[model samples]
Target: DFPPLLISLGDLRRGFVFHEVKQVLITDEDIFKRYRERRQRWVGEEEKKIERWTELRGGDYVVHIDHGIGKFSGIKTLKLQGRKCDYFQVNYKGTDRLYIPLDQLDRLHKYMGDSDHPPPIYSLEGGQWRLTKRRVRKAARDLASSLLRLYSIRKVIPGYHFSLDTDWQLEFEASFPYQETPDQLRATHEVKQDMENPSPMDRLVCGDAGYGKTEVAMRAAFKVVMDNKQVAMLVPTTILAEQHHRTFRERIAAYPIRIEMLSRFQGLKEQKDIVTSLKNGGVDIVIGTHRLIQKDIEFKDLGLVIIDEEQRFGVIQKKKLRELRSSVDVLTLSATPIPRSLYMSLMGVRSMSMIVTPPKERLNVETQVAEYNEE
Candidate 1:
């Protein structure tokens, strides 16, 4: 191949090749200096990473394919060619030793396992198994892509149109059992702005459980429904959908909103009837577990989609949801971060509203820990 463009493409000099080219284009000296500074900072960060890897030792949780998650017992030193090399002694599976080299620390991660987490072990020398894993991962990615395409098509399709009015707002607010908290009010304002704005809304409402998140969602749903549009409430669990359906029915009972649920628990006849109603604008709001995403279900005027407990959704489900809500506005409510890595990657691109303050009535509980004998 020809010499790289960075080097001169001319005749050879006394000891080097030279070429006549454009002058240095460093017009902004400040920008050039900043670029260099950033590059140097990244280099320093990489050096720190390498230093950390080299000095890794005991008490650290190391993840190995065969050993899974285990605490480093200590290091074993071996003298080879007058130089000493260290190996990490990881304790796993009842005295199981995983001799990982200090150099390989880059492959490990700090294990932050929860109560339900199962210890992972090292699957060393399992090349065939890894290949199988790769194939499975690839298949899953392909399936997700297909589902996303379908969702995109659905989102682009225009659904129901809504009219702007404060009647539903007044009715819903009057029916609210408790006064709205400051966080709830802020979230409500954000959702309302998203719904009223001509541009499609894609907002995430993150907060702890029982923090009036559902109420905020209800307010948005009511607004959408009042606009002569349909709302889709997508939940990750059947139980949650049922709960939401009941809550929506109860909250909007004072209004003329017709909310329905479509889940596996319902018979085929019920699902069919609900789908028909959705297509004919008979149902004002439809709430269901991921079942709401099925191809058979059609929304007459799907204006807003509220995703509850979004962290419970898998990569495929979240992708599918995104596609379905591409054109329409989406409101995602979650306790923690979204489970899908894709959403995290696109966080800056998406709108997010966090309810950090707890409701007025909710109080923080203090806990006391003591020895059993002391009690």
Candidate 2:
């Protein structure tokens, strides 16, 4: 037996304890489990909200996985078999319309093609869509085979094996202001491991904008520079090249590494001097646009090539990159990767690391559409 505890009306009024408690719960395991399940469901719904089709409006082009490209006319509710059901209305060429039930919305995707010229809508008759898909599949297969052959050749050729990180590298990374996310750390580790191996590194780092993809590339560049090898950062446009040049300079300011930018913005004499410096190993890292691939530009010992927005490069520029792929380490960074890159990564032809975790306090981008007005 123990002394009796007094219960006060003040406690009950303040919600500290119940006035007349019949039963007391000992554990909250069930409540916690339910809370977790609800949280997961909320996350799933949020992801679905960001799907491309959610923003589809009337008159927008859409592609049906089985029916090819068509124009979205909007949703409609119509009576079918004595019952009313909601269906997606899609209009094809020459008054051809398709009604897809709401249950099959997963088969539709917003059309992503050239904005200036629309793709030809496939006819629903005569199996033309099937034939077109078959031809595309064959082309894709051939492309994959060629990519595999190229990757195999790259594996056989030995590349510059960079040593592990040094004291300076640690210090440089520690100077970063923000904490590194888990995905960023993992991607950095994988890149360094690839550099340490003798095989050439052809890894794709896919992440959204402002997700520290540049930080990963900078770390790799620092490692390569530590081993007395140069790094060439190729961008798609002059503006991008300039932006990267600024970023690299700011990040490596305390170090003795020399970074130069090559674009049409530089004077003729300055361009010649930069090119000379590259040939004589005066420059450690170079960030440039397609101008870097011109006949005159040369590097003393380029061990790493970082291509930003690789999909934006044209066929000719990419062809030149393919030639370099056999010898030097290549790292491609893209926020919106093209289908070829995705397929290559999936097929194991090239290594890939994804930085999916956004930074703390980072908010989702908001998009708004309005009619263009001169004012």
For candidate 1, write residues 20-85 as lDDT tens digits: 552332223333443444234333222223236545566666654423466767778866667777
Off by over 4 Å in 2: 1-112, 120-142, 363-375
- lDDT value for candidate 2? 0.85
* TM per prediction: 0.67, 0.66
Candidate 2 lDDT over 194-300, as tens digits, reads 99999999999999998999999999999999999999999999999988999999999999999999997899999999999999999999999989999998889
Give each model's clash number.
16, 0
The regions of model 1 sitting more than 4 angstroms off are: 1-61, 64-73, 83-85, 90-107, 111-163, 339-347, 363-375
lDDT of 2 at 227: 96
The pairs that clash in candidate 2 are none
Q: What does candidate 2 score in Cα RMSD to the true structure? A: 17.5
